[model samples]
Target: MAHIVGGIFTSHVPAIGGAIARGLQEDPYWKPFFDGFHPIHRWLAAARPDVAVLFYNDHGLNFFLDTMPTFAVGAAAEYHNADEGWGLPVMKPFPGAEALSWHIIEHLVASEFDITTCQKMAVDHALTVPLALSWPGADNRPVRIVPIALNTVQHPLPSPSRCLALGRAVHDALASWPGAERIVIFGTGGLSHQLDGERAGFINKDYDRFCLDHLGPEPEALVAHSAVDIVELAGSQGIEILNWIAARGALGPDVREVSRNYHIPISNTAAATMLLETPATLSKAA
Candidate 1:
């Protein structure tokens, strides 16, 4: 049986890591939350899961303004980070776990969950940038990535319930796969913030805290709320909460919050990280 090593809930604000690296955490606004990840180096060393099922949403980079699938999976042997006109350097190539990815794809499609699979696609910086920065130990080493991207950049995206259901589908698919030793399920995106238009730079620490609370103890409550309402609280582009539903699914009912950090200095971004595991995870490590 496979167990979720932990869940990391964080913002992809791009410059945050550089800020931390430059000791900008002492800059009054970012110090607390940035310092929170200090022990993370040790944690990653300990858990050291074989792979991470990265759930992220494309920002008009891969899908574009064209037709976008509600849910897409990357089963490619490798994913390249191409230019996204964002001025950031291209991300290093990621080694995707194609074997498990194909297994999950086959299982999910057979279970009637429509999934768009990509092989020859270039992964946008939105998906690859933040990921590459997180692994301090990963000095261009290829770590297997199982990307489960959502069509969140567009309107009429899948409802909250649908995302939650998709999480279960992911959980079941991985659990049913044989000989999978350890896995980490990552839900990347927001707590509450908005980017775009004049209304940009909106930061709602209150809403972000509510998200962490509800995501941990009462996910159903959060899911029951409509996307429109959440959009109002989380901002127009705040629909990224769907990524959190996948984290909830990975954590299950008996989820534990190892640590949580919420900050609003970056204006349009909320930074957070959470660790989740089952009782069986310790034995798996043993």
Candidate 2:
């Protein structure tokens, strides 16, 4: 059976990607933000999972107002990055795990989680930026990916509990796969800070810190919050924290937090990153 090595959580801010592309890690204004991802880079180098189950939202690249699925999974052989308006430095295409993608889709639907499967999808920064941060030279890495896109931008988004339940479903689906593969899950976006409207440039370090401290050990505490609650406190886009909740649910209760980093003001967003692992004993049992 396949084994889940761990889950990664991070903020998917585009400016962070720009910093990396320009080699501004040591620049005074960008130094602190870049420093937050150093541990994640080192961890990926060490663990080197075979596939990454990425959880992120589309920023008008693939899905626009025309049609949007609440939950979608990418099953294509490859996913290319798109120029999200500003023409951020485009990275190499991401290799996709079609077999695993189909398996997950079948399982999620059977488990009653309605999910749309995309054979061809162009990912925006929400997907590419975090990949750049976790696996710096991704083009040369051996990792494949299964992209799970959520609809946080539109209203009637999935509830925190529902997202958590979906994560648990993904956990079961991956575990039941009849292969000996190492997989890492990631929940991307949000640590407070809003853009747009009069409340733009808002930051709530205390609320963000509360989530970081509790999400791993007590994710249930977060499930009680509605999208409105999060938007009001964390910012409109702050509801993206639901992605983290989903990732936490997939990790199960027997996890060891490997490392965590949080910083404020990464281009109108508070940035955060965390690495979590299934305990060795739990992995063996599963």
Q: Would you list the C-alpha lDDT of every candidate in the order shown?
A: 0.72, 0.85
Q: For candidate 2, lDDT tens digit of each residue in 189-255?
A: 9989789999999988988988998888899888878878888889988989988988888777778
Clashing pairs in 2: none
lDDT of 1 at 95: 80
- Ten residues in a row with the worst lDDT in model 1? 133-142
Q: Report the number of the highest-TM-score candidate.
A: 2
Off by over 4 Å in 2: 281-286
Give model 2's TM-score versus the native structure: 0.95
lDDT of 1 by residue, 82-197 (tens): 76665556656778888888988998898898889987556764456446445743245534778888877777778888888888788888878785557777787776777787
* Each model's backbone clash number: 2, 0
Q: Compute each candidate's TM-score over C-alphas.
A: 0.90, 0.95
Worst 10 residues of 2 by lDDT: 277-286
Native-referenced Cα lDDT, model 1: 0.72
RMSD of each: 2.4, 2.0
- Spell out the clash pairs found in candidate 1: 9-272, 25-31
